[model samples]
Each structure stands twice: as structure tokens, then as C-alpha cells.
Target: MSNKNINRLFEALTPTTEQNEKMFQNILAQSQNENTRRRGFAPVKRARSVVLAAVLMVCLTTTAFAAAYTGLDKTFLKFLSPVNNEQAEYLSNGAYMVDKQVANENGSLTIKQVIGDSNLTYILMNFTAPEGTVLNAARYRFGDSMITTDQDYQSIGFKVLDDGNPVDNKISLVMNIMTKNSIAGQTVNFRFKDLQAADPLPGIFETVIPGSWETAFKLDFKEYSNLYQIDQNITMFGYEALLNTISVSPISISLKIQSRSLKEINEAAGRLKEIGQNKYSDNYPITINYKDGSSETTSIFTGLHLLDYLNDQMLTIKTFEHVINDKEIASIVFFDKEIALN
Candidate 1:
């Protein structure tokens, strides 16, 4: 599509201020309802058909974008929002580098790594996983994690692999286990390879449980950091969250680069800028896949800024799909863009 047209598409996807408030309220209500239901109270029942019908009405009212397909026969509604504007310089060597440090009340972790090729534009993250006693065959809910998207996190699973076997040693299997209840019993060992790249980013990486369960099960990182010895924790969440976070992070970084190629970047930037301008309806959505077998569809509004970062660069997005045993599952997409550093 022409850059101008793409820009308009993006603008349409940006949600209005009022819409944002409404969405926030809806989320709060949903959470409260879930809490109530978990307490053995009769849950409030809203008409599913009515809700679906209303979402359909919203979808039909907007012409900018429509749901191409709602997988799993689920009702899908778009919640779109525009991102902030920023600029960054593109490295010619096909690599970009990123390093981040995250701290919580209990402890902290630092991530340093090259994302792109070492000889090209490279990005990297370095972080040490907390070590603790392993809880075997433990299952935890992820609905309470601090994530930004609407996708369900319950579908994601994490396991500790030792010689290809699921192990209960939490400290040693840092890269494979997803959540932990307590760090008191056993230690596990894990390497970076055990962490599949499909693992979600760090922002939404929080322990999952109900308030009571969380209160009873959660352990402070400080309590186990010294006693547990694990090299890496490869935690994976729902496929959608993992893909969305990865795309958003690098795209946000690219926009922060300083460069003189406005004309080239503008081509891509215009598409994003148009979204900011509200040229189209707020229902357009886009799907992203990763190099691993994971895919997610996010509202176009959420990804518009990433387009602006690319501009006129030769970029290709490829999705990798994989299946194990007979189940068709897992996929990831790689975003490849060519830039002239000199």
C-alpha cells in the first residue's frame, strides 16, 4: 500500500481517549468478576451472545480493518492505541544491541545481549535467573501478570528439561521452568539453550496465582538468590504475549535511533503518523510471527509506530511454524530490515 494510505490505516486504529477509559473500566470489571467467582460466589453472568453482538457491531461500524479470522472460534474485539514517537539511527551491519536491568523489591536482574548479527546491527540482553528449590509438576495461573495485551496467558506452559526430561529442580532448570510457588526444597541446573527463544519478554514475567495463593506461595528473590544456583530461566508465556513483547521492544528501540535518513524513514513513518492522525477507524489489526513457532495478532494501533521506524528500508517479515507429535502448534516471525550504516 502507498505510505499515505498505510498512515491513514494506522490512524484509524488508534483508540480515542474515551475508548481507552472504557477499556480500562472493562478490564477492571472483568478482573473483579473473576476474583468474585474464584471465591465460590455465584459469578455474574453476562450474555455472551449480547457481548459478541456488540463487538460485531463495533467491528462492522469500522471500515479501516476487520478481523480476518478469529481462531479457536472465539469472539474477538479490537483494542487499539497509538504509541509514542521517537527516532534512532540504523546500523548498516544488520545488528542492533540492547541491554536492560530490571529490579524489584526482592532483587534485580540485568539483561545484556546483541539482538541482530554481531557483525551487523546487534542487540543483546544479559540477565541472571533467580535460583531456588524446585517445585515439581507445579501449575500456576498467569492471568495476574503485568502484561499489556488482552490475550489469555493460561495457554502458556513452562517445564524444566534435564537430559530431555522434565525435572523438579527449580534452581537448576532456570531456563525452562515458567513459574515457581516456593524456593525451599530442591535446586536445579539449566543452560541458556534450554530457554527457547519463543520465551516472552521480561515485562510480563511475573508469578501467577490468586491473591491468597500468591500471598502464600510467592518467595522473595533475596531469600533464594544466594542459596539457589541457576544460570538462566527460560520462562515462556502464552504465544501471543511473547511475540507481541519482542516486536514492541525492538521497534521501540529503533524509533529511538538518531539518523539523517528522514526521507527514507518517513516513508515508513508516514504510515505510523497517519494512524496517529486518526485517518481510519480503530479496528485494524496486524499479525506478527517470530523466528520460533509463535504468532500473535495485535491491533494495528499498537504496532503503527514500528512501521514508522522502518521507512524506506528493504524489510521482510517471515514466520516460522512448527508442530510436535501431530498437534499443529507454535510459530515465530523474524523481522529483517536492510539499512545503510554509512
Candidate 2:
């Protein structure tokens, strides 16, 4: 097949897992039919064996690609989520290295490193199996986990990056923690109850050796972000919004916004709900323009506080998929109005 045809064939194939077996079976049937048409003899068993071998090759190739990332630098480059130059460089320098490991009967878990500001924290962790043992799963899910901080906080959420792919023997995981207050300078306690491998079908799981593990580490949060205070009224989706402030960090950019009236708040809430349902839609709160003449749009809206809806007071934080270099930002565009940063 030509290169373009090969690309199309690969794209046409369903993703690996539960559908993989059925797809291979169809290929085997087709191969048998073609062989019989040409030679008047069907090699059914041979065709079946070849199809199964193809499946094995696909699995092995994926595992090999995952294993190619050896060290911190290479591993960071393999992050499924977008990692900008600033975040990658900081991780490469070992500026926030926390090589803490906790081992249980199941295996060992290590906190490779971390990077965060006040509102968010990103943790890099690795799982290593015992000698003669192997964790050969595409992805894993943690069960009954409790992530707490030393200080009393409003809320905390710990999530393993589902978007990331896993490797055999050594599984690398990224934990994204969202908190009500700054997670910096605070010691965090991580407790996990059970670990399971995601099964062939969605919502099905298989336990990974019965065991639990726990660990704690102190986070060194540094303020390497630029904050611009802006109190202006902007019209979005035909509703008036108050632009409170814009904080530009190396890893992400967040914008704080509010509504001017209760009616506007309710209307904006409904509109945002509609936008959230569509994954491909971009919430046009702010656009970051870099010095290199490139721009990025906000991927999601987070840190929403609507308890004070009566006073038309709410905090809307919009985040970018890739990191934003604070120094390289030229300006921010909102509703066709450009605010020069430099």
C-alpha cells in the first residue's frame, strides 16, 4: 500500500482493546476468502495465526514506544497533555525534584517531581513492580484515595491523568491537584487504597495484586508568575462580565472574572453550561498572544465559585492546555479588544 493508503487504513482501524479481537477476526476471514479465491484452497488456520500475530505486534509496538522514554527529560516530553518550554525546562533542571518513594506488597510508587502555583499543582509519579513481577496494563486507576494538606482548606481534588498512556514494568503517572488555597509551602499526605488495571471494556477493572500505599511530601511553591490587575467591563455572549485580574504563570494562565448583576450571572451560568458540553468549543474569555506572533485560546473554565450569586460575585478561572511564558506574552485579546502587556 502507498503511504497515504497505509495512513488511512490505520486511521480506519478501531482503537485497541475490546474491539481489537473482533477487528482481527474480520481481517482473518477476509484473508481466508482471498486465498481461496486465488488458489481454490483456504488456509483458514494459517490466516488465523497470522491475524493473531498482527495483534501481538501492535501491542508490542505500543509498549516499546512507551519504554523509549528513559529519564526525566525524555519522560516529560512524552506527557500526553501539552507541556510548554518553560515547564519542561524547570522539570529538566530538577528545580522541584521530590524523589520520594513508598513501597507496599504490591509494588513501589515514587514521586518523581512536581510543579505548581497557588491554585494548582502537577505531580509526576512512577510505579515500579517487584523483581520477577510486571505491570503490563495500558492504564491504571486508583481507588479510595485521600489527598490532604496540613492546613485547613476548602476543597481538594486529586486526579490521575487519564489522557496519559502507561508502559509495562514501569508506569508513569501525573497527578493534577486543584485546591481552594495555595498548595505551596504545605505538606501533602497521599493515601491510596487499591490499584486496578483498566479492563478491555469501559467501566470494567481488574485488581492489581491486593495492596495499598501512602506517602507525604512538602511542596516548595514559588511565585514565578506575573499578575496584571484589570477591572474592566467586557461583553461576552451578550452578557456583561467584569474582568478582575489575569495571572500569567510559566505553566498556565488564569483569568478571574465576574458578572455585574444577578441576571447577568444567571444568564452567563447557563451559557457557560452549554459551552462546557462541547469538547471542541473554545471559551473565548481571553487569548494569549506570544512575542513570536503566535496565540493560544483557553481550553477550559475552572475554579468557579458561585456561592455569592446574589451579589453578582463569582470567580471564573480559564486555563490553557499548554504552558504560557510570562515574559514572551505580548498582549491579551478579549472580544476584539487588545490589551498590550509590553
Candidate 3:
């Protein structure tokens, strides 16, 4: 494949209509938490001040912005989806419309929501320590809570945020998990162990959080299946790339693309560098074209990073998942306008 071929491929890209743009924009905002900040603890005395500040934010942005957004207006989850070089094969395409809060022996834990696809499950939750409990005492870790289904499952990274520093002792987290099973709509266990802080740890926040806050429950969630499939090949900058799989659900979409060799990717990157092209690091420029002629310009949140290009011939495939579910999409315009998979 030559550069001429790549340019020709991208030239065939299609643009979308107007009305459908809003829908995709909303999805981008919701899923990416574009301008939303973390919901920290706010004291009543500070209520007025907070309200004023919020008002300013709304004024600067828009009234509709302030009125909208839920706890689902999260940022960490987006970062978690693809922090390092990992690819998320499947993620929950569930709307951020879940509120599963329950009380435990030591405190209360809210199962904010659960989302996943056939390959992985992401459980988001908030833990409130018992009254008069100073967090940071213990690590407040969750024991093995991966669902024990016929398929294999394992825990990845357990993240806990103490809102803003240590305000009202409310912590939020998105548990990173992976499994080789299809455990959707199945009752799975959610077990979190108590945190014993105030230990000799070498990280941030070295304080004791009093509590035996153990939370356990059976959570039921729905997993999305990508109904439409498209597999095609395009040689970009002399690299033969395979657009392996594309699955779209009501809430999210996933794309699995592979390349033949890493050398080609390296060469392609070099060529882009030579041409002064911007890098595709944090975000991907993707446009979803629906059947209604309305198209959405949203971003692509990455997941797991498959095989290495150097050691293996397989190229690193970018995983796509973001919050957006609306009318059925007809095709997608991507690869710098190089390809359109209908």
C-alpha cells in the first residue's frame, strides 16, 4: 500500500447532517464528562457560596448544562477505560441511569451502576464511611468480588476517591475487571471489604479511616451486543490495516481494528510525523452516520491493548466505547476520512 492509496481511501469519507449532530454531541458530553467536574462534598454553610459558584458555571456554560448530568457525569471512568496500553474488548452500553445504594454493617455503599459487554465488566460504586469514621485509616479495599460464573474472571485495578481531599468522607470508584465470559443480566456478587487505614503506606493520604464497612450484594445488569458487523482492509501509509469488528448497542459502540505488522505502524507514524500530522493519542476523530442522514461527531475511549507490534505481527487495536445511544446508525466515517464502514 502506498501513501497515494491511503489518501485516496480517506478522500471517500462522508460528512453527516445537522439534526443528528445534537444527539451525538449529547452522548459525547455525557460519556466523556467533557466539562463536568467531580461531585465533591459541600457543606451547608458553603451551600450559598457553592450555589453562587455553580450559578457562575452555568452562566458561563449554559443553564441546560447545569440542569443535566448525573453522578454518571464521571471523568475517572473515561480515563480508566483506556489509561495505559490496554484495549477494552467490551464495555457496558448502559445509560448512566443506575442508582443501586445499600447499607452495610459498617457503612453504606451505593452501587452506582454496572456496565459491560461480553469481554469485561465495569462496576462503579460510592462508599460512605460510618459516622465519625475518619477515612485513610486503612486502605478500604474490596476483597475478590468477581462473579464466579462458568467463564473466568479477575480483578484489575480498584480505584477509590475521597471526593475532594477529605470533606464528608464520601468516596467514589470504578472497579476495573476482566473476564472471559458472557455474564450479563446474571445476578453477580459485589463484595467490598472494610478499610483499615493509618498504616505505613507510601502513597497519598496517610490517615486512619475508622470502620468495618463491608458491602455485599447481588447486582443484575444488562450487557449489549453489537448487532451489525463490518470487516474490511485498508492500507494506510503502506500499512495493511484490518478493521476487524464493529459492534453498536443502544448505549455504546465498540471497534476492534488490527494491523499486519508493527513495522508498518512505525513507518506510518514516521510518515505522519514527516507530513506534520497531529497524533492520535488521547482521542480519536470518529463520526457516526445514522440512517437518518444525521451524523454524530464523538470521541473514542480506548480499552485493552492487545499484542505488541514488535514481538508479534499483530498491530495494536484501538477499543472504542463512549456514552451515546440514539437512532440506529448507518455507517461510520473515520481514518482521516479514509474509510466508511456501512
Candidate 4:
């Protein structure tokens, strides 16, 4: 379709008020009446227009209902939905119902408060878990957790930490966990804090499963914050005996701040190149230091990139030192050249 027609269709699809729905219904009724009135007297061309208009109305109605249904489904699926024979049995035997009643009766899971500043946001949650269930760990990601374990279902409580406390009302999070067998259970009473400046760039957070019980996760917060001025951090708490079961620790946190501009990183790269050329030699080690405390020393011909130069008959530079300014913020280092010995 033409761009203008597509834009018009989008505008029409946007919901404005209840009057729009009423008008659509009226149009539909009128079209039906017209079809019936012309059942025996209309020309073929006029009949085709009426039929096309009726079809368009039906299409609009279908699109509206589909959008509404999708939203409702998403809301329902966000919470803990029963999954497996074990969970179903628990629900059937009135375990979940009893837990809900207890939660309602005690009223212990209440929103404590929310706090935030210009650069940070925080929400504090205080609640207790049910009997037989202990919170093993809590993690926040840009999306849902990839944990697939039965122990997640046994979680009873959760706490979320932020760069700063929220300044407004408390934010609520509906906690859900997956068991070892890939079963998910829902528990409420978790707190949520949306940081205003915490935006991770694309492809920064990558998860690599090293073993059955251990996963290596890497976060390039420096590279991420380079794209935006927002600073973000992740704080995780491990709980119960499951903490020992996993390879990681009790509490692990990572902080990335928007401290340096893109120009600073480029300047550092340029300085490294100049130092590398001046110190290049056949058998001497090259060392470069920045005003900041950060430094890297590596053999020019021994690292991963050296394999690509095996066929070249050039002098094999083997060692070098690099130094750059270290700001209180995050930084990225790019090796400009291999170190050589004189």
C-alpha cells in the first residue's frame, strides 16, 4: 500500500474514546441495513462497494478484539501459573489456597516505600516466605530470568536493590521462579525499582552456561554506557543452601557509571597508537602508562591476534606496556599494536 494509506490506517486503528466504538457499531449496522434494502434493486457496482465496506468494518472489529485479547493474555501470564503435576497437585490439595489465605490474614507483605533521585532509583520490599520454601537467590535482568530449576519454586521471599532509593510510591513486583525440572511457581510480595539512568546497550549482557550448575555471565557495562549517558548496576543476593549449590557467591554486584564521554575513549586509543610506534623494536619490551592507574602489558606476538600474522616475515615484537587515565567511571581498552623487544 502507499505510505499515505498505511499512515491513515494506523491513525484509524488507534483507540481514542468510547465514541469510536459506538461509531463503528453504527457503521456496521447501517451497512447491514443497506445490504438488506438493496437486496433486489441495487446495481452490481454499488453492491460491490457495500460489500467492500462491510468487509473493512469486520476487519477493524477483528483487529480491535485481537489486540484486546493479546493484552489480557499477557496480564494473565505475567504471574505464576500452575505448571506440572506437582504444582497442580499442590493447587488441588488446597496448598496454594491456604498460602494465599495466610498471606491475606497476616498482611505482612506490604509495600514499605520507594525512593529515587535524579541519577538513581530504589525500592525497598519487606515480606516473608511460606513454610517449606526458602528464597535461594534473586536476580534482575532486562528480561525474565533464564533459571530453569525446581528449587526456584521453593523461593519464599525476594529483595531488590537499586543505585538509589525511589522518591515516590512503592513499586510492586510479582515474583516467579522456575524449578530444576523447569516448573515455574508464582509468589507475590517482591519489590521493583526502575532506575532512570540504567540503560544497557545491545549485546552487552551475554549468558554462557559453563556446566550443569554453573553459568558464566559477562556484562560490558563500559561499552554499554558509551552509547548513552545512563549509568546502570546489577545487585544479586543468593539465599538458602542453594547458594552453595551454585558456583557463585552470597552477594554479587556490578556497577557501571556514565563518567567518560566517547571523545575520551577515542583520545586514549590515539595515545596508545603513538606510544606503540615509538617503542617498537626487535627485542625490547614496550611499556606505556596512562595518568590513571590502569595498564596492560602483553607480548606482541603471543596473544590471540598473533595467530593471524604467522605467515608474515616481519619482526616478531613480543612485549609491551600500556597506560591510560583511569576515571572513576568505566572504560574500554583497545590494543593498537603488539609490543616488541629491541
Candidate 5:
């Protein structure tokens, strides 16, 4: 078949919005069922396991959409759906690629590319196990926590690389980190302690392989990101917040804001706190508006209260979902206010 025909076939197999949501709910359910085992570790692994299972199932049922994204180095394709031309155009601009490798007795890991801004860092890598080990459908559970040089940044989780069919003794993965400060020109040390591979089970992930993978690399955030100073203030949840900075990259956008009135502990200390219900407002919506009259929004906000007793200042970081061309943005709408960017 011709390349154009092949692309059409893959696009046809792509899941719709409802189908994607159903798959997401299934992944969530699987993760919840195994929450007992995922308490101490990061919540990303459970999600990854279910995603791997779902992807496997989809590949088996649908012809082979993975083949469409074979040579593309962008890791975003692995997570986002409907690999259409528009999505490809968003990531068409090449990233600063890296070819660093680290190995030990168990296996060798090669860092393919590094992309990020000050607020987030994404590492694209592939791992190759020793002769006897088979890594097909393998997921790792870390014994100790994954740490970085900057105490402010923490590893969110691992994203499995999509390579159509699982290759024997080989697996691709993406390491994502949420940063409290800029990681530009900073060396990050990664230690995957007591690494154990999960057995090829249906839902639950049982450890079968035991080992560790360690590597360190420096990040040049300036190479991939553009930092913009927004010194704007907006009020939300009955409190005022100062939008300090916004950083943009090819893969994501990160925002940092501060609020002095947002107290760490409210006076309603007697009642049990409600979960998943934002009573102050229906939802704290953060949107990124593009010049073309389109926008993207995310409600997930990470708020860190600092010096509550002394100054009562709260710091929050919001990471947007869509990959964008930073230069094309017209403004950013925080709640009701739209702060113009250009």
C-alpha cells in the first residue's frame, strides 16, 4: 500500500472522543483497583500499566496504527490520540536531540532527546536488557523514590514509548518531571533503585525482573524554551494571586503564581474536607488563547503553600495539556481575566 493509503487506514482506526474517554475510565478503574500496591510510589506507574494494556489491546484489535508513527522522535505521539496531520504539524519543528548512553550488568539505556522548559522536563530514552531477559510488555516498579538534583523538581511518572509491537529485550520510555524552579544548565542525577520488571499479567503488575538503572545528564532549558514575564494578578477561589512567570516550549506550557491571602489552614477546621469538589467555584479554568481564535484549557492546578505562618503566601503551578507554537499565542485567560501575550 502507498504511504497516503496507509496513513488513511491508521487514521480510520483512531479512537473517537467517546472511545478515548471510555479507555481512560478503564485505565482509571484498573489503577484504582490496584491502589493498595501503589500507595508509596508515584501514581504514574499504575496509569502507565493500564495504558500499556489498553494500547496492546488496541494494536491487536485495530490493524496497526503504531506503524504510522515509527520514525517520529516526538514522545507526545505516544500519549496523544488520533495521530492526524495537524498534530504532526504541531511537533514538526525538530527538538534539540541528544544521544547519551549509560549501561551496567542488567541493561543499557540510551537517552534519545531532551525537551522541556523551566517548569517541566521530558527525557526520551530506550532501554535494552541483557541476553536472557525478555522485556516484551514489561513495566517497572521502583524500589526507592526517583530523585533529582534540584530539590524543587520531582519525577511525575514514566510514559511508555509506542513502537507498534513490543520488541524483545527492548523498551522505550519517557521520564517526565515537574519543576519548582528552572532546570536550565543543571545536572540531574537519576537512580532507578531495585528496579523490578512486571510480569505479563492482565491488570495487576507483579514484579519479575530485579535490577537498577542509574544515569545523570545536564539540562539546557534555554535551548528549548522561551520565558515570558507576566507580573499580572488575578483573583480566584476568593483570593488574589500574582501571575509571576509563564514558560513555553514545543511540548507544554507551565505557569507559576503566588497568593498571599490563600491560607494554608482555613477556619473551617472542624469539618471533613470534601474531595474533587471545588466549592469556591465550579472550576478554576486556565486557558491558553492562540492568535487563530482557538484555545486550550486545564483545570488541574498544583498549589504549594509556603511560609503559611509567617507570610501566608501560596505558590501554584499550572501545566497546560496541548502542545503549541509559543509564538502564535495571543493571550492567556486565567479564570475571568485574559492577559494579552502579544
Candidate 6:
């Protein structure tokens, strides 16, 4: 997309001062917390063969959490959710790198790693079996001693290797675990109960949950300090849009934007819920450069919500995809100009 078009899309997200500050503080706290952490998961339980989905969390040291997939598939690793180059850096640098491989009769379960800020956590896993072993389905969940507000957290989610593609001996899995209610600083719990696998490919053959494959452990809510910012105000196509805050994460930017209005600001927004989180497909401008020397520009925005308070029409925005290449972003091109942030 043209720089002008991209900026126009990004300039739409505008958040209020309080909202901006809160977002900034939360990010800072997560980044600062990264400095204080130990990397090792204490396994609570072990399930057997083709059925090893549940993994409990335990605390451990960094030396014990090393990468083991050196000989494994790099192509598959890169494709796993949240395990891009930047995320790999995050795992090697600080996040607990769980490299425990539990053996099974027909295959094995490798708990790759787990990384978490105060708000969200991601788990990486790999399931390897005999060439013909058909790993069908799995379900898991995350819990803590303290439960955050229902709205603050999301249910555990997982994505298996190839998803709809055919099965293979070695496959990868990624998860998105959300949390709130002070879950960041505290040890969290997990469970992976049901795991099913079929044999000799899919047909009239019966499916079995395998002998066992459940585990438990605690994840040290290690803090991460990987946030960068680019604060500026610019006039795009005559309208003044303030780039109030640009928060960086392992793979993306946590952005906040705002514009001024004397009235209640988009009254249509007030009738519904949240800020710019509706079907109002408005375009904005943004450019991001990754540490890998790659960059992208897009006017597409998601994870957006419009929050209106008083006369302020603020919009919260984050990148629609894993646009940040470097764990530390190199630059952000805005207003048709190359600008370095962080």
C-alpha cells in the first residue's frame, strides 16, 4: 500500500490520555518484569503414549530450559503460532524454554516452551509419532490460583501442525492462553486431559485416547522488557491525528490512537459497545520494520475498540498480523517518511 494510504488507516485509532497511560503502564510493567525470571517447568504429572496433551506447569531454572529441536524441522517451527524469529529470540533470551520430551509407546510429546506477560501466555509443543500414527484431536485449559475477571481472560486455544492437511510423524502445536486478575506475577496451573489418536490413517478404524498423556506444571510469570515507542503527532490529509502511544511486543505492536472532538464524538459508537471495534471498516496508515531487515505497511487494523469519554474519541489498535520482524523493531515509516523508533 502507498505510504499515504497506510498512514490514513493508522491515524484513525485515537485513545484518551487515561486510556493511553493505562495501556502504556501495563506494557512497561510486563517488560520490566521480564528481567526477574527463572526458566524451568516443574512437571506435575505424566500421561502415556498418543494421548499426551495435558501438561501441568512447574518452576525451574534457565540452564534446564534449553532448545532441543536443533535436529528437528525448522520449516515447521517457523510456521508454529507465536514462534516467529522474534518469538524465538524471546524464548532463547528470557521466556521459559521447556525442552522436556516425554516418551510414549508409539510416539513422543515434546513441551517446547512457554512465554507469558502479565496479560497473555503462549505455549509451544510438538507431537512426534511413528510414520503411520494418526494423531487426531486434543483439548487443554489453563487455570490459576486466582481467577481474573471473566472478561479479562480467554479460554485456552490450540493449533496443531498442518491443521487440515494430512498427518505426519512430527507435528507442532501452538496455544494462546489469556489471563488477568494479577495472574502475571503468580504461578499458574494447567491441564490437558483428553487426547485421541487413530491408527493406519482415517477410515472405519476406531479412535482411542491412548494409554495416557497428561501433565501439570507452573509457569513463572516472568516479566519481559521488549516494548518500544514512537510518539508523534502529524496532519494526514488535513486531519490532525496524534500517535499517542506505540507499544511493542515480541511479534507485534500494541498501538493506541486518538482524535479530539467537542461533542460526544461518534454518537453511533456510544450506541454500541467499545471504541473502534465494529464493522466500521475505516482505513489508517502504518509501517513497521523488523529486526530481520524486513518491513511491511498495511492499512488493515484489527483488535480495535473505540472508547469515548467526555469529548474524546479514542481508538485502540494493534497490528492485524505478526508484522514486527525483530523482537526489537528497527523503524516505523509514517507520513511517507522513514522514522526510527526504538
Q: Quick one: best lDDT, which candidate? A: 2
What is the C-alpha lDDT profile of model 5 across 195-219, one tens digit per residue?
4555443344545555666777777
lDDT of 1 by residue, 42-151 (tens): 43464344444555555455422322211100100010011111111111112211234544432233322221210111112222333452333323222322311122
Tens digits of lDDT, candidate 4, 1-342: 233432343345465557555656777577668768877676767766776676567668867754443221111122213233232222222211111111332123433322111111122233333343332222322122233222322222222332122332222332322112112131223222221111233223322111111122111111101112222221111111100110100011111212223233223323322225323222112233333544433333220111112221111112112101222213322123221111
Q: Write the per-residue lDDT of candidate 2 for residues 1-342, one digit (tens) a residue.
A: 233432343343335566677767777777777787888553658767888888778667655543332223334334422234334444344336689999976788888877665556677777777766666665566656688875333333333432234434667676666554457777878887677776443446677756788888888746445678888887766777777777666555555667766465455545544343334343445677988999876645544333355556554444444445667789988764577775
Q: Give the TM-score of candidate 3.
A: 0.45
- The C-alpha TM-scores of every prediction are 0.18, 0.62, 0.45, 0.22, 0.61, 0.45
lDDT of 2: 0.60
Specify the highest-TM-score model's number.
2
lDDT of model 4, residue 212: 16
The candidate with the higher TM-score, 2 or 6, is 2
The 10-residue segment with the lowest total lDDT in model 3: 83-92
Ranking by lDDT: 2, 5, 3, 6, 4, 1
Better of 1 and 4 by TM-score: 4
- Tens digit per residue, CA lDDT, model 3, 1-342: 233432332332222244235544544455335324656554546655544554455344543332232223243335333211112222222433456666755677777766665555666777777677556432445543434455533435455543455656667776655443346656555544444343334434332433333344444555665544456775545666676665554434555556656565555544212212322342333577866677766442334334345443332222334334323556776564333444
Candidate with better lDDT, 3 vs 6: 3
Error of model 2, residue 167, in angstroms: 5.9
288 Cα displacement, candidate 5 (Å): 2.2
